[model samples]
Target chain A: MYKKILLATDGSKHSIRSAEHAIYLADSFDSVIELVYVVGGEKSKEDVLHSVDKYEVKREREEKLRPIQEQLENAGLQYNSHLLHGEPGPTIVKFANENAFDLVVVGSRGLNNLQTMILGSVSHKVAKRVSCPVLIVK
Target chain B: MKLQNLKQDWFGNIKGDILSGIVVALALIPEAIAFSIIAGVDPMVGLYASFSIAVIIAFVGGRPGMISGATGAMALLMVTLVADYGLQYLFAATILTGVIQILFGVFKLASVMKFVPRSVMVGFVNALAILIFTSQLQHFEGEGWIMYGLVALTLAIIYILPKFTKAVPSTLVAIIVVTAIAIFGNIGVRTVGDLGELSQQLPVFLIPSIPFNLETLMIIFPYSLALAIVGLLESLLTANIVDDMTDTESNKNKESRGQGIANVVTGFFGGMAGCAMIGQSVINVKSGGRGRLSALVAGTFLMFLIMVLGGVVAQIPMAALAGVMIMVSISTFDWSSLRNLHKLPKTDAAVMLITVITVVATHDLSKGVLAGVLISAIFFAAKISKVKVNEIVALEGKKKVYKVHGQIFFASVNDLLDKFNFNDKVKEVEIDLSNSHLWDDSAIGALDKIEMKFEQNGIKVTYSGLNEESKHLKKRIGGLSKASGH
Candidate 1:
């Protein structure tokens, strides 16, 4: 019954594993996967006024998603890639809820400070906050 | 040093700075007097220091718009000196403190402030808040409910006045109205005049009267060291906060030297030493101050009030000032930290609590921060010590890959070394470090131990996917690991 799937990655090994699980789920459900990598720098007004270099961040995101894209293409999975910008946790939740994604597939735990603060483990925030089912893969 | 920055920093926001300066000047009056009492000096001494420091720092300070004045944190450091060596020696110490601070600036010690952790800063803030609140209690001694009622009234005015208009400072209004009530209502409360007499004259320059000997130098040096450190810490932290608020950069080294010069000048002018006040600086900024003229105006206005309008300022009730300072303590405190204590990691919470308790118990700001940093470091070391090294064997036990995870240092090198049992049926081992980082010589030593142990067992140990830093550190440590060949 799933039409759209959101896959969130932060370039960690765990996130890459989560992308693998997302690709598998998209294949079974016949859903188009939306691969998203958000650059988390806009946490406050000060952060917005002095944001991190978006150009460099976009390039880094593409590099991180390369292997995942190759896997999806090999599996004949239809996917749309997105390099979003904002604080990781709130931004991810907002985007998924607004787009009416059928499922959000994320890592069980994130490695970066912003991601850890946003999700903080155990019945993870994405699983708790998102309207759609959140599959937290290890 | 660009002319554009100089003009923009000083005059681009002249009107705002002047208004902010006036508000800061009003706030400084009662605070200077109270801090002077705490420092065991005449009220005018605090005023002189407040004025001189503000004026000099306005022209030469690193922070363009921050308000520097007589502060309780610096005053706390002075109490012991004044009690032991008397005012002359205290003056000598203040000047010495300034000289030392100037040297610190020259040596680029201001950048060292980054080493101070945010937890320590929060702890310091909370401790100062408690100290300020407790210091105000003595003024309430042997008083009736009427004095308390007046304090409550003053607090109401301060809290409420802001909502109606920002044109006038609520603190100034609160002080004026409360003092007017004290005079007309025949309230049995103490005023500034009750604390000490007013001279209302210009500060006369005087050299500190102390013998230029080792004994004198020894006594004053310790006090001077403490003053210089505390003064710079408070000023630099205040500057940082203001920079964040205004989104601007400041010459921190220049600010340090400027505070030194200000204190030296104020010491020569028969005043106690002072530093930047975060509360007043915030008030100045919020009231439209974004330039040097604001600080200059504050100093001139403080002097004008003391010298020309001494009679009126002297009559201002102590209760009103108490209300204003209590508000300052409230604003100065990190209320969010307290609220988020439960959300914080146990280690961070413990550090913040330890800092507050240590500072409160000892009444020493630096000691509390040190205590917090020490405990935080211990906890941090303990946390990183848990990073494990997982070994995965592949290709029918012929190829074994040891995956190192987390940080490697003196504390956790043993953990890395312990993983090489050498009893496994694997003939070759690849130590994959792409997922981890190498930190020090101890880590390099641990790698060598792993290599030797594997060599003894006829298994080839190879490091794979090492980061640049790890590679550099390994090279520096001189062949900590062997090549891929057997």
Candidate 2:
């Protein structure tokens, strides 16, 4: 039923796992995979520059995507990677809504509904407000 | 060094402070009298208490702009004391209550006040408002037309005068106009003088004869305890309000100590009990009261009114005073908080309701707050206990990989530890955080103890998806750092 799957990543280990899962699903269905990464706006310029310089953050993001990209290349699956800057949840939702993706896959930390409402989780917000089905892989 | 800070300069920032003092003085006069009357003491005692406490708090308190004096909560407390023990023993009780507050402050017990739930505060305020309104009903009797006219005039002045001018305090204007008409304009109204004579001298030291006996102490101790709690609550709440309004930090312990000193002094000077007065402090802030000058000026003004213009002050009708108190009561009720409480969890709502009902029915403010705190703690404990742990084993060939689930804490520590079984087939222990989301100090300590015990048994423990807190615990314990490798 699913065709184009957009996977959002914060370059975290969990997001990498989600990316791998999205790639697996896309390869299985012979569907296209779109990879998206977001940098939070509220963070300082120095912090953003530092993250880039450290290579730790970039390595994790590329490491997660590189394997998937290679696999997709081997399987000849249509794929693209894009990076944007803003708040994680809202930016992801807005991107998904505008691009009209069929399925969105994300990861959850398994925080309860009330706590997630307080210390808001991106996956929880996306699942609650998104128009299409959202799979939150914990 | 202290004097240098005090005497730095009055012309620059001090001008604003002086202006604020004048405005606070204007606001405090009516309030002092109104609160004293609520306590069933001579109205002059209220004025005296305000003057004494305000000056003392200004110098000794840690927070600036928190005008400490006779407050509504203390007023409500005094009513029961006055009714049961008469005015003399009420004074004695105030002295004893002051000693208790002093001890609490000395022990630095002010932080304990934070455990008072927000729901309880809302209930206390609403109940106090009802009590203040109820007490004012006495003045509204007999001269129905006059009382109605004064009330209507006060309300009009409060509503209309603020729209035209910011210089004139609407409440002060209401008091002045209503009082003048009641005195000279042939208005058939009951003046303050009809109730009692206004005293002109400064408060004198009066040793209360407490009839030093267990029976007397037993009779008065319960009342004193209630007074201490209400006094502490009101003072701390006022300190918090002043902190927000002024955007300044306060030493809660120091403020409590200052309150204790002020009350003890008030009791010694033959004045009624006092706490931090919220209305006057707000007025002081809005009117440019920035420092100790505002409080000092208010106290000076109150003394001046009593000594020089005693007769003029006496002309203020009881109905007019009642009108002023009704305004104060409405302000203290916290209508927005009451509305928000309805939106909170059912348990919170129930606690809030119980506090309100208990306070109203028993006329005991402390008991209500205590009941609310007790309920809130129980709710918290129950929630903490609900966090469960699961044990899972994945068998591969001849070895079994053990996984532990749930956030471990003191509440769930024993259950989690008990679930672990040492067997010949179990080769590896993986404390899994994939499903476990969080940990507290007790849980970390528990994990450290378990790891030591496992090492003694020659079994190794590895972790997966160890979240931030558990990762910190691993670093602290010098264990292998668990990182999720991409």
Candidate 3:
């Protein structure tokens, strides 16, 4: 039932596990993966959002995506990489909804409870807000 | 554009300005008296200073909608001056302070604004909000739950009523309704009269009798300098916050000049030095005040409160004012700052935290700003100092190419120096720098040293990727000056 799978990662241990599961699902279903990373701040509107300096984000994004990119390459699977910015949870949900992604995947914990308590919990808020099917992996 | 059109642009929001100014003037009375008490001066001095500043800044200020008046930040600095040197010297110092602020404006003190990082700005606003909120809590004391109930009701009316009526501001309506209720019901609580007695007399011109001389100037110089710095900082910062709220730009240097001129006139009128008040400015903006007329009206209304409406003003309950200011503090705070706390760079978050703590602890805006700038600068220097030299031993027609792939500055020169090995088995060495930028003399010096050592070892040295800036600076410093043309 999936076509475009959006894998959202925060480079946490739970996110790495989610990345692996998303990759496996993509392989089995023979679908393209929309590998997305959202750099967060509070500059998010209902739909639109602004970004900070993207160069540094680009560098870190590359490093975070290297392993997943290699696995997809080895499996001969096609994928697209996106580095979006805003409040992380809303940005991800909005991006997925606007792009008509078939399914969404997230880590069970994003930077732990303490960190998310400030910006808010990405996975919990995404589950509450998004329209698409979500798989919150541990 | 025609002059009429220009005038329209300047005074387009006259109605809003007048309404907002009246509300601010009403709000300023108790605050001015309280701050004057803090500075150990007669309450009238604060009232007169606020009046003078409000009127003067209306004419010359950069921010069209901002309100300037006697502020706690200015009062905190004046406590020492008023104590150490008598009121005569305080007046002399206030005049000198104005002159110094005018000099600061002439020198374009606004240029320093570029260095104040975004994190510090948020911290500053947030701290001010906290201070205002907590300060209002004291007024809530002994008034009991009934007072709190009134505060809540007042806050509710201020926020909820705007949806129904847009003619009169909700805040002013709230203030009027709550005060009327408190007085009609004969509530057992503090009123504006308890804050300080406002005289029903006009202020007359009184020049400073500081015996104008070298020794007198010297005695007042330090205090004047401190006042000038603190006042400008408060005014500029308040202006910036208001600009954000109003979504308009301000002329920073012009604001500095206006504040200085206002202070000078205030001193002659027997008022203490003053600056922009953030709390009152927020109240103005929230109440739809949007032009110079608002400031003028605020000042004029203050004089009216003293002479014509003293009885009515005194009857206004402190709880009502407290509720209004409590609303101001709540709205002024940057709630998004807390939400973005975890997402911000740790260094930036640290700087913001430290700034807020310092400002609250020291009660000195200037010191807090300095601490934030200093800490941010040090952290920024440390991060930029991580410029690295990447080695790429690629064979380009029998030559070894070593590429440096980061910014080259004094801090990174040693890294570049330590990475070079002259004994690399090659006929020539091409240092590729298409990705690197040369920032200072030391970097070029390091390159020269590398070339010299390589040439001595019988290997030819050449640069492959000198960007325009690198090439220009290199040529200017003789690194490539004698070698080639741009």
- Residue A84, model 2, lDDT: 59
TM-scores, all candidates, are: 0.74, 0.66, 0.67
Write down the lDDT of every candidate, Cα atoms only: 0.81, 0.73, 0.76
Residue B360 error, candidate 2, Å: 1.7
Worst 10 residues of 1 chain B by lDDT: B477-486
Error of 1 at B36 (Å): 1.7
Shift in Å, residue A125, candidate 2: 41
Off by more than 4 A, model 2: A1-138, B1-3, B8-12, B391-393, B396-486
Q: Candidate 1: list runs displaced more than 4 Å.
A: A1-138, B185-188, B454-460, B475-486
Structural similarity of chain A in candidate 2, as TM-score: 0.75
Cα lDDT tens digits for candidate 3, A1-138: 687899997666677789888888988888899888775422211011111222433455578778767767887889998866545777798898899988899987746655654435778878888888999986
Give the Cα error of residue B78 in candidate 3, in Å: 3.1
Off by over 4 Å in 3: A1-138, B9-14, B37-40, B83-90, B133-197, B209-250, B277-289, B311-327, B396-398, B452-459, B476-486
- Candidate 1: CAPRI quality band: incorrect
Best by lDDT: 1
**Model 2, B165-209: lDDT tens per residue?**
769788889999998897778876777777666888888889887
Query: Residue B430: error of model 1 in Å?
Result: 2.9
Candidate 1 structure quality by residue, lDDT tens digits, B368-454: 877887888888898987777787879987998878788888898867676767877778899889988888877887788778788
Residue B272 in model 1: lDDT: 87
